[model samples]
Target: MADKAVDALSENEARDELARLSDLLARANRAYHAEDAPDISDADYDRLKRRNAEIEARFAHLKRQDSPSEQVGAAPAEGFSKVRHAVRMMSLSNAFDDEDIDDFDASIRRYLGLSDSDPLRYTGEPKIDGLSLSLRYEHGRLIQAATRGDGSEGENVTANARTIADIPDTLSGAPEVLEVRGEVYMSHADFADLNARQSARGGKTFANPRNAAAGSLRQLDANITRDRPLRFFAYSWGELTAPLAETQVQAIARLKDLGFQTNPLTSLCDGPEQMLAHYRQIEKQRATLGYDIDGVVYKVNDLGFQARLGFRSTTPRWAIAHKFPAELAWTRLESIDIQVGRTGALSPVARLTPVTVGGVVVSNATLHNEDYIAGRDSEGNEIREGKDIRVGDWVQVYRAGDVIPKVADVDLGKRPKDAKPFEFPTTCPECGSDAIREEGDAVRRCSGGMICPAQAIEKLKHLVSRAAFDIEGLGAKQVEQFYTDGWVKEPADIFDLKEKFGSGIQQLKNREGWGEKSANNLFDAIDERRSIALGRVIFALGIRHVGESASNLLARHYGTWSVFESAMLEAAPMEGPAWDDLLSIDGVGKVMAQSLVSAMNQEAERASIDRLVAHLNIQEAERPATDGSPVAGKTVVFTGTLEKMSRAEAKARAESLGAKVSGSVSKKTDIVVAGPGAGSKEKKAQELGLTVLDEDGWLELIGG
Candidate 1:
């Protein structure tokens, strides 16, 4: 597949290639954009996308509906409230080399019906390798900040954005309404310092500055974001009440004047040659820029020209991102090692002969999964030309603004004579439990559950995490020590620590690094957390696929732990009213429901939960303050197309008014807002005798 050119491919091959490309690109998007962790290099991703586009061009009729070419970024990640952008945030077209730049210029000229000699000024700015953010301001005050999700909607991160020193809380002399778009970035020095601190504290360190910036900005807690040094550079606008300027350069100047940071290297270029020159200049200074930038962006100078050029489905025709070449080097694959995660995922790591990539020394790289090592995708499609990797083989390691290097290509010709295809282990490397690869799952997982030491230790760490019990003086290090000493093996064991090790022969104060004061403090902290909120309690359990937001949703829906536990026990059979009710919660899916039920029904797990419960007081989830709103505490369902606002916007508004927004209509549904084309849900609501309202009625009732 790698040897075959797009022009030489048959229709069937092209179709298969398209499918492979779509899946790879989609996963890459989620990894990079949503998770802030990229498994593939930018150069490799670009090559796959280019190949997909070329194949689609050759076989237009074979283009899949879920083509990567038609998509923007991945959908907004869960746990955060969603924000619908007033003006869609579009991505830019890419230009790889001088020829591509020339083609881009030519295309713009052709679209404008102008000759090559005609005057067309462009603005070139360094494309910062960071997260895209949109800040909405009203009446000169910053109101909301959101990430660039799927172009249409994004995650609301207003509190986190407010903590960045580079962003102004209130803009003076700005438009009545303005939506400033920029890149949230971390400087190399700051990123290095932050990583150093994280490593010292036994916390997770990011691989690169871009990931650090994104991870920081998207933190659930703003105080954590405030601690991380983040910066922003405004380069564009989204929604505006009035025009800022007639040209792009003037608009940027106005933004800077309004107290927003703008990239200083931005310059006006008369044509493609100047743009290329600026790009080369930026490339030359990239190493010394103090910040990470992957490319240079060229945009039409005149706002009028931009308006005339408009946009493609997901990209703007008036702008292009000319990416820099990836840094790559040859390295030897010394060995393959499997590491078991808390979720029982057997992740493969490639121990490499030490080499340098992108000015960083690399001794390791991510092998992604067993399928990737075997040169195949999840669907058995060929990858890396179906060349499997083996120990003692020469591999091409690539680093593209990622902390960890990746083996992009293997030199099969340079393979060692005795090298053999690596066999992935069929059992957990840590606990000797059988590893199973479920249907549709890319990675094989250990089925040992709580019996596995790795899973048990990680779950114990999670139980005391900041979002869970958050016991002071008890962190990952303490958890690991306690687990290794056999003082704490499960959640219930944590509660018995005082009685077991507080005095006599097994005294905790006598342990290394533990003075009497510190030991007392730790015990006090554990005791203080004996009573916890229901959401935190649920999250602390570390159920598969159930996150903080889902925990909260379940807590709100069930109200009490006894009721929730009883319901889960009833739903263990996986049917009837209890199961239906569990599935009725907006975000609860079948997989999560099953996981919850199984955890509750399992003998050992249930006994451990009950034991832990006997020692603690769990508070009911707090309801949102109604603030005199009419729909407060009511359950509302919005079905079909919403005319006044997007579904995300409507849901956000309803939630803000203290109304619960459910995806399905059930007996608990208090109101149903049905728009045009509303069918099943509307009819179901009518059948259930639930109050139904049209779009206009919904708007009127909410006083929107």
Candidate 2:
């Protein structure tokens, strides 16, 4: 059956569905990876993801290899030496609801040929969202700490790993050799402070704590990695030269004895029912857990049974990740402030008294918009239900992990007598220019664009970013100088730099750190960068809604710079059919379309674009489609718990090879490649008339 038959949606409708899918997945990605608080219900997100996969599978030709459906996990990053695991690391199948868990238990019993009366003990622990690394110690001295790469291969970050306070540099009275696997994460407070410092320095702040840890740990310079406040929680082990324990519980206990930090939440269950109870208990207490936990991980407690029911390509047959229902918490509302993003959108922020929840402090959150703050829901109550959260009012805070915090609810009973509703400003907070809230949207944006000083400075910096022009001598300082000297105002002014600075550039030779050779080298480097990739050029144009990934998407979609530019101009001004159709392209959005039109409508911006285009040559190598790739647009589902590679890696590899790796499957799924003890996804695929493949087929498709 076709995806069209499944929904009978028109092209526009299909595009809308895809856009919603993209936004949903991206938000989930941010929540799971950056902030930790997942906004959408897990079951709903899973359904959307499955539907996305079905759509992509039905229309494989329209699918990008990098689609979010295929981006289930990330690959092990560079800067570390690679090491293959003795036993492959696999990820666990997940359950978002009690029914799902029940189904999972039923499947497990059936797979093991166990009667319902037979017992199966499980150990449940918090599932930490962080970088997964396997640490090896010889005679109790830490030797290596490698990321859970492609199960077999991972990069070594030994030096950086040693800096983690919880990881013992040496263990006393331990096994001759032990390979313990755990997660490396940044505490919520550390992440907040890091983002604050980055903001103060006018640098980009990370979206969440996990990203901060991931970015920090993957630093090329070990010293940089050392500066990060990283913590670890040992959950499982890979190998031990000597027997560490007779059971899984004892193995974890031994790991703790070897100076590893272990979660105290671990509990033994008599069977899947007890395991499910433990999962619920953890979910209820998730807000109090100091670290971010999206779900509870349950593993078979008996080592003998574990050995008998071993692993698949990327997951174990005996473990599952049972996710918690998304919840929102309440906090006191201190004040509301507006922030200007790089794109000049004025975002509303709520400040609150410091409170600790889920192992992190919460002092601020996103209010989203003035409408959100001032408007009301179906009931005759304020939109956020607390008279727009005036200063001193009590408000609710919610998160799944270290996410951009948001006020989930409010308590009017706790409001102070003197507290009054906040009056959102009509002018840009940064530039005093009149801000406009476009029809059909909540965001209030500054129409000033490059004319706004703050926006202008940020734009200049963006124009010369490494991915953009790659000008060696024209760094932020140089650009600032040029701006101050009135030698450069717009991006096009960069081309006239040589004529204006020809003599002054020679004077650069006399600067304390500059030599004639160095000065000339900088000029040559700038000249070399005059020609760049078409994607970079598109990105450098600073079109709103067009980010690095979107630029790449558009570049691949349009092929040529001329065609892309023409499309933009033609797409501008047109609102209904033409605009919607063009913007409906997978990566482009209405926000992006409006920005392009607004930018192009201005004569100054148009002139700058024409000037820059005439003076520069941008080219790109054609990327031919890899039709021969077996994994092309295939749907992959990772089940059970993995030991070698993190669940993220398995998903990333499948995607990089042109597969659509979704959390679940529907009728549109071309094939469902499942790991051990497949869960709801496998059953759904079967129900939807989809074919199922095993781990061996997955490996063959991925060319492993």
Candidate 3:
């Protein structure tokens, strides 16, 4: 039987769908925002979010705390210092078609209690397809710049922002305290040039202009950003000490006057018809535009009206992004290939007959997973009307500004008579190890561990990735070559390259791609990274769930490599004070902790880590400077209802003061703030003889 529509779904079905959407959207946000790599197309992501919203609207009680409707973006990536936005940076809700646009206008009018004849104007501006940046100016001088990370906090990129020519370092006649919010993008010509240069130098190339812009702006080194041709378009404001103008269009004009690059095509539309007409005009000119714009954003023209309309949890009600439709093409599925990631995930790729989608020729598209190919989602809901994909079948491919194309639908009428359902592999394709799909997991993973060449090579590549060791001239290609040639099998083998192959009959200089100068440069780069920070070292290990941010959190919590190593070794059995302490670190969950422990306690992995450590000097993790703050370096736990503030507000405040907010109570917990309805956690805190405070007490302690 076909699944019911979202409105017709039962309470249980709605709850299950909500859970599935939440997980998928969370992964999508992390890939797009934190990693600068989008796993799904914009259209598919928007569709899932729309379905999630419809279900939530029908069954409000089934709405999850971590609903897609409530999240803005992923948490900020590691390596850069974080900045908390004075005013939250909100995302815009999307409108796919003309009907959605009409409904949007009508809903705004209804909410404001206005008639069709009411003079409600809107400002339509191109929505730049790039990274969102917030530039803060104090006394007409740029003081800080940050990426829009998780809405509330962002990564500090002031140095990189200073290098962009379009972003003025000093603005004349600007507000004393102004935060200009805009999009940082790369022009078409610049993007092509950058890719050419990257390809020539054997460096990683970007998939699109947006990724190029995001990667360039988020660089750890400012000089790299300075060389990249990045542009900015100021379309909004945040935390202004004084209003720029009474209306949106006037405010944009004022921004342009203040030496900011405001979008030239921004116009004031009298009504929905005019707004949509302007959208169509912009769409027609999209091909000629020098930069990339995914859509047009429409906002209420009157500043007062916008304030009255107010904001939702993650988006503003006054604005919506009228997105362009995804480009689609029909192609034949030539074959299905399984590729293993560093984490051993068996991702399926559909090799397709060459076809043009959105002006780009695509020969491969993402199958997502076996379940996706089987025409069902993780919750067993049918997708593409339960049409299973097969080799040699005609498929509809879609491209929505994504790096990879996606198989949107399969045409059963064109299916070949001999077509057969794809059988997912039961063993690793590279190492022949048993591949297992654990309960609740969509992708199957290889059990070969270090022995699997695919996983091993990918892990080695990840060890030297930009966010990890970041060795110059040692990218994915070089890592793969070294691994295949038996020159490097593990992290420790990399350090031994200079000593073992520096001067011998089989020398690095004798390699096909290496000269004396280049070989020495590689050695120097490897040597320079011998004394890396603890966070980078942890990230380079390539633990299953320990990403850059999680690695940094672990490094900060443990302080030193020896301490972290010892704790993980002790926590391997999954019980005891060490395990409890590991679990007590903020953002460290049972799954992450288990992964860390498994990697650290496994005999072969431990030996490899020991060998790697023997050849390097690891620095202690830097602690945030809190000076005289009472909660600095303390671990706090909040339980029950907080009357003074929301739980999120309390956690943010605590973290700002250099405190860790753990989700659970343990003996290592420094304090527990209890409120009405506090039960087990309160009792546990008392039992452990930890400091217990009420909501008022917490406020008093924090100097409210």
- Measured by TM-score, the strongest candidate is 3
Best by lDDT: 3
Summing lDDT over every window of 10 consecutive residues in candidate 2, give the lowest-scoring window: 1-10
Judged by whole-model lDDT over C-alpha atoms, candidate 1 comes out at 0.85
User: Model 2 off-target regions past 4 Å?
Assistant: 1-125, 129-158, 162-182, 185-275, 280-294, 298-334, 356-359, 377-386, 399-404, 411-418, 457-489, 492-531, 566-603, 614-616, 624-704
**Residue-level error in angstroms, candidate 3, position 329:** 3.9
What tens digits encode model 1's per-residue C-alpha lDDT throughout 361-473?
56877786798899987667789988999999899998765545778899988998999899999999898999998765667889998889998998897798655787878
Per residue, candidate 2 scores C-alpha lDDT tens digits across 1-704 of 01123355444444444544554465455444323344433444554566776676665434432345544323343234556677555656566677876776676676666788888778889989787888888887888888765455666788888878888888898878888888998877788888898889897676567777877877778887787888999998887788777788998998887778999999998876788788888878865665577888878787877776665434677787886655466777877888775466676778778766554556766665675676453222455433566888777776544443566666878889999878888888777898886643335678787777667766887788644675766766777766776777888888766666776466566656667787677767767877778888877887654555666666765678788777777777767545654554543555456766677666888888899888787786345365788767555556655433446557666666765555445444677766666788778777887777776766665677
Q: What's the residue-level lDDT of 52 in candidate 2?
A: 73
Model 3 error, position 296 (Å): 4.6
TM per prediction: 0.66, 0.56, 0.71
Preferred candidate (lDDT higher): 1 or 3: 3
Model 3 worst lDDT run, 10 consecutive residues:
1-10
Model 2 scores a TM of 0.56
